[model samples]
Target: MTTRNVRFVGGPLDGRVQDLRDHEAVAGRLLKHIHLHDGPKIETQYELHYTPENGWVYFLCGTQP
Candidate 1:
């Protein structure tokens, strides 16, 4: 098994990157937070990138129209 890095781009959190063992947990928490602030209808995407060595990588969802 491998670990993953998180990266965000083209949004409010652009250029932000994070290294976490439980990125999925982090992502879930973030999504919940956004839902509370932005509501369930918010437009965004959470992108995940997979690596054989480092692990899964992801780009945090940036709100969009």
Candidate 2:
């Protein structure tokens, strides 16, 4: 058996915007902008995860197209 642990570098964004919906909205906008500027398609599937301890959200994996 093998075990592995991973630690994230950044913490949650604490300020005026503290709601999950707000966060999702912001992320959605960012993704839309990225796609528009970069391209219409992405080669890899990007995973976004949220945690209470970590704060808002973070990306699990990503690859450049």
Candidate 3:
């Protein structure tokens, strides 16, 4: 059974975090979506902060200005 349902928000990964059983799976997905770029872009990198609250596993980061 899944440990819990993670709800992603405030970035490209604005959806429910799936595949909770696999660490690699979650990491891979986060890496892909968190960057906000689906394509292969080496420059696509940002600081991610895990701030789970109110039964939600979401994040908050500075947007591009």
| Best prediction by TM-score | 1
C-alpha RMSD in Å of predicted model 2 compared with the true structure:
12.4
Kindly report the root-mean-square deviation of model 3 from the true structure over all alpha carbons.
6.2
Stretches off by above 4 angstroms in model 3 are: 19-53, 63-65
Candidate 1 residues 1-65, lDDT tens each? 44546655444455667765653634233431133355445555566655567444455656654
- Taking all chains together, the TM-score of candidate 1 against the true structure is 0.37
Q: What is the TM-score of each candidate against the true structure?
A: 0.37, 0.28, 0.37
Residue by residue across 1-65, what tens digits does model 2's lDDT show?
Answer: 33222222222211223234542523322221123345465333333354556543434244345
Candidate number of the best lDDT: 1
List candidate 1 segments past 4 Å from native. 1-4, 22-43, 51-56, 60-65
lDDT of 1: 0.51
lDDT of 3 at 45: 27
Point out the worst 10-residue segment of candidate 1 by lDDT.
27-36
Which pairs of residues collide in candidate 1?
A: 3-54, 3-55
